[model samples]
Target: MPGTERSLTMRFLAEPKDVNFGGKVHGGAAMKWIDLAAYGCAAAWSGKYCITAYVGGMRFVQPVLVGNMVEVEAKVIYTGRTSMHLGIEVRAGDPTSSEKHLTTHCVAIMVAVDDKGKPVPVPEWVPVTENDIFMRDSAIRLMRMREKITEEMSAHLS
Candidate 1:
């Protein structure tokens, strides 16, 4: 069953407890859902315990409202020695409707860990189709961009 799970999707309904007095759900609540989905995908793919190392490009495009159904999808886009990069999305819509609007987008880097809590090797991911390749490449490019940005900031600050 190694390298079999490529994606995970979860559905939930936004409740009043998840929202503010303004009738919109807090972004942090949605982020928790994103983390859950990403963790599930990483754990399933690696077949080991995992920890979240990094979360990048978390943008909330829309606010979820009470009574709306929310769907969180996590897809494995790439993997490294110990990290699995998962592309995550959150969408929300009225339960009676067939349409959902994107509420968030992000990528999470999860590191597989051993009993000692140290990073452990994970199975390599292979792209089987053009879309798969594109997603993997996108994750690679995003990682590079983050590194470049970090380098630029460190150079300027010091």
Candidate 2:
């Protein structure tokens, strides 16, 4: 099943407070924005409250400077039972030039939960466009990667 595209964008004014001593935005701050964006996408797709079950493949492609406006976008790529896969991208925009550059990409898996905090099934999703196919495939790949990572982690723990 395919899910819809739910996106959110925000212009981040990198104030001095958001910068490190080196004048670059902190990775933690960027991750916080990523989470927020992904959560919004997942909740919108689920049409209910959802909790993050996993996060995957977060890579920083570029550094956001102190004055760059960071935009985070998240979309639903796949859904299964109670889980929804969200693809999130963070971009840095130069307000002076009106140029945007991709800075980070991440995948988040969220599970819809009931009032008792137990997992609940999500409604059927339909993807009727090429973009939807791309998202669905990306989600499948991310889910496979997550399974492999979990297995490796469990092996180490054991």
Candidate 3:
């Protein structure tokens, strides 16, 4: 069921297939999980098809090993007319244990789309709780930083 309309969480086992030669989960696999979780949250909130517009501010905090329980959570921290800014977190823990630690975190921006792939409006997200307020503010801050980085990258092409 729907615990939260603006958030989605997925849990799975980190399998050997997901591991790299270093015996840790591959970075690409982790990124794919993040994108999937963010997409789920965006689609649930918008009730429409969504496409990933951007993913950034990624931090790999720790190694996620095979046999670990992996949890990927995505929350809609902010919403624009057609875009949703998601705060995604990946956690890992031994299934035998109750504690989980953060392994990865990032921000993903998803745009809702119509059947023809045109952008469509997303439901507005309003911060109510303290954590919600903080996350929304953080999303805005990340957006500002992203704008600066884009501008700098574009200047090199001129």
Candidate 4:
């Protein structure tokens, strides 16, 4: 199945500079890639500049190694008045081969903004396929969970 315009895929080679002292691609580098991919998807879907409002459920399942071919895919799964929820996955494998394994997964919330940097409405997303529906539902669940966590933390910090 082909992705709609609301999705973006980025592919690149993991470089030595991305590696940590342990020789694996650093988590920060992977996070940067995730943010970039999510921003691209949100901007394309909304047809406006977007800023990351939140990133949740980020999990590093495996380490990416230098020389690996990295692929990051971001898909718009849900939407609010001004926010687009994106499901992002990062995968990596040998540069010479086609096989890839999941390295990271997360949901990012991006808010479209106007020239003045104020939040603006984004185009709504509708899930048409089973997979899309599943992703959207998952994103919603993650959002609810994040809200609960935030409330809990606020009680402690406030």
Better of 2 and 3 by TM-score: 3
* Cα lDDT, all candidates: 0.92, 0.79, 0.91, 0.91
Give a tens-digit lDDT track for model 2, residues 24-103.
Answer: 88888888888888777777777777898887789999999888877888877778889888788889878787778999
Query: Which candidate should be chosen as best, given lDDT against the real structure?
Result: 1
Between which residue pairs do clashes occur in model 4? Answer: none
Q: All predictions: root-mean-square deviation over Cα?
A: 1.9, 2.7, 2.0, 2.6
In candidate 4 the C-alpha lDDT for residue 59 amounts to: 99
lDDT of 4 at 21: 93
- Per-model TM-score, in order, reads 0.92, 0.87, 0.94, 0.94
lDDT score for candidate 4 against the true structure: 0.91
Give lDDT tens digits, candidate 3, residues 1-158: 22249888999999989989888999999999999999899888988889999999899999999999999999889998999999999999999997999999999999999999999887888999999999999888888988899999997894
Task: List where candidate 3 sits over 4 angstroms from the true fold.
Answer: 1-4, 156-158
lDDT of each residue in 1-158, candidate 1, tens digit only: 65799899999899889977677999889989999999999999999999999998999898999999999999999999999999999999999997999999999999999999999999999998999999999999999899998888897884
Query: How does model 3 fare in lDDT?
Result: 0.91
True lDDT of residue 129, candidate 1: 99
lDDT of 4 by residue, 43-99 (tens): 888888899999978999999999999999998999999999999999999988999
